[model samples]
Target: MHEKTIAELAAALQAREVSSVELTEHYLRRIETLDDALNGYITVTAEQALEAARAADEARAQGRAGPLTGVPVAHKDIFCTEGVRTSCGSRMLDNFVAPYDAGVVERFKAAGCPVLGKTNMDEFAMGSSNETSYYGPVKNPWDTERVPGGSSGGSAAVVAARLAPGATGTDTGGSIRQPAALTGITGLKPTYGRVSRWGMVAFASSLDQGGPMARTAEDCALLLNVMAGFDRRDSTSLERPGEDFTTALDRPVKGLRVGLPKPFFGEGMAPAVARVLEEAIDHYRGLGVEFREVDLPNAGLAVPAYYVVAPAECSSNLARFDGVRYGYRCEDPRDLLDLYTRSRGEGFGAEVQRRIMVGTYALSAGYFDAYYLKAQKIRRLIADDFARAFQEVDVLLGPTTPDTAFRLGEKTDDPVSMYLSDIYTIAVNLAGLPGMSLPAGLADGLPVGMQLIGNYFDEARLLGMAHQYQMGTEWHRMAPGGFN
Candidate 1:
């Protein structure tokens, strides 16, 4: 039961082969048994999950169930859940229990999917490696000693380890796709405004977009159908009509034009990872997919540009967490200035502080034009490059990361190198385009992911292409040894 995909589990629930309670308990047990080593989840809502499962079973018996009636799923800690802790993987919010459900959480509830718990993530979604998480870094299920890419590492790890069938994740730069690639899972980041940001903890507001993480594109499609909807509370939410993301899963990829950016194939990529990518391209070519070489001249500037733009936005959004209203507070205040300084200093981790300082400096009066404005200009150039490529090709393809998951603590000492871990993915966020990562193959026994970038609001086409490729390969089905 734990091994079934969301679609398979939905079918079993509809067939009455298993009750929602039984399915929920199966996962709860697995999480209880296996999660100690992985630290994938920050909180386990067993009581609430069981109650929700019972209600779903009752709804099914009365023939009032939805398509995802009994599916069990986990939420990234960044999302607010009413009466549950939404830590955002920080000490500041460790004791902060949300008073309301995030927009995505509400949608999943409406679809009758039981929430298993909240998963761990980087401190305020600021790190590439999950090591900055206050709860503890999430270990990759594939190799326990290695890191699972962040800040969606916990979400990706849970699904990869089969603790949950699917989970919600937010992508600021490469949070979803990078971790998915490292852990051998399917992750999608929809176009910027396609999903609501209401109740999701802010992390670079302009770049953060929540999406789905699961084992297959079909499962991600089902989750996306529920997650992608407009919410009046979120000003950034798109007012577009609802979409059935699964509609294009079986669409043929014959004659589909795939663009391979020359910059992504240049120096810096590991030879093993490049080999796996080449093999995936060969497989796609055999499927009648057409490949074309393209150039993203400014793509090399994505990392430096993202560091400025994202931190600037994060500085503005995170201003609400000062010692006044809620969240962690320092001991008896010496004064207003001391209260503010000590509270924040004690609440946030080192990485979060580093970003806050960098952002403050960039947005400072003397440096605004020099740093923030320049980064925004570079951002436009990157977007224009993607626009040009899209005019010539249907989709852009590249390696998700420079290499497979690295060992924990390998790059934590060098923040520059850590930031570059997202070199291939940050530009998509800058352009506000939809991007996805699908398991292509293994390199040195570690999973490698192929990124698929689509035109604005073209998630369906990306899912269609990934699903078609998955149908011809079993890479997505591979699991960690002990987990299987």
Candidate 2:
């Protein structure tokens, strides 16, 4: 049951072979046994889960279940849940429990999915590695010594280890896809406005978008059907019609034009990772998917621009964590200055503090135009590069990360190196485009992901391609040796 995909669980529920309550209990028990070592969950809502599962069971008995009814899924701790601690992986919000559910949580509950837990993440969604979490780092399922990527590391690790069938993740820079890549799971980061941000803690507002993470792209599609929609509360939320993401899973990829951006395959990429991507492109070619050469000249500038823009937005977005409102306050303070500085100093971890400082500096009066404004202009150029590539191809293909999962503390010392881990994924966010990562191949006995970027609102096509690849390969089905 642990190895079964979310889609498989849904089918079992529909067939009456399993009850939602039973499924939810199974996952809860697994969390108890396995999560202590992984440190994946920050909060486990046992009572709420039981209640939700009971309701799903009742709905299933009445034959009123949705496709995802009764499936247990985890949520990233960053998403607010009424009466549940939504810490955003920061000590500042260690005691902050929201009064309302996040848009994603509401959607999942409405679809009759049971909550498994709130997974850990990078503090304020600020790091490429989960080490920035106030709770602690989430261990990679593949190799416990290696890190599960951030800021969705816990979510990715849970799904990869079969702790939950699927989980929700947010991507601002490569949060969703990078961790999924490292952990051997599939994840999607939709277009900028596709998923509502209401109740989801903001990191870099303009670049933030939430999506699904699962063992297979088909499951991601099923989850996305419920996850994507219009919400008035989120001003940036798209006012587009709902989509059936699973509709085209069986669609043929014959004659599909796959664009291979030369820059993504250039120097600095690990030879093993480059080989895997080359193999993936060849596999696509065998499926009659055509490959074309495309150049994203400004691709190299993505990391620098993202560093400036993401931190600047994060600085502004995180200012709300003052001691006055909900979240951690100083034990005692002599004055207002003491209150502000002490609360923040104790509340934020080293990495979170670093990003806040960098963001604040970039947006400061003297540096705003030089750093923030220039980064924004460069962001436009990156988007333009994608625009030109999409004009020639239906989808773009590349390695999700430069390498597989690294040892837990490998890059923690050098912030610049840590920032570069998101080099491939940040560009998609900068362009406001939809991107999905599928298990491409393996390197060093660990999984590597192949990323597919599509034009805005082209999630369906991306899923279709991923589904086709999964059908022809078994990469997504493989889990860690101990877990299996």
Best by lDDT: 1
Badly placed stretches (over 4 Å) of model 1 are none
The segments of candidate 2 whose C-alpha lies over 4 angstroms from its true place after superposition are none
Task: Write down the lDDT of every candidate, Cα atoms only.
Answer: 0.95, 0.92
Write candidate 1's Cα lDDT for 375-431 as tens digits: 999999999999999999999999999999999999999999999999999999999
TM-score of each: 0.99, 0.99
Consecutive 10-residue window with the lowest summed lDDT within model 1: 314-323
Quote model 1's TM-score.
0.99
Model 1 scores a C-alpha lDDT of: 0.95
Please report the candidate that would top TM-score against the real structure: 1
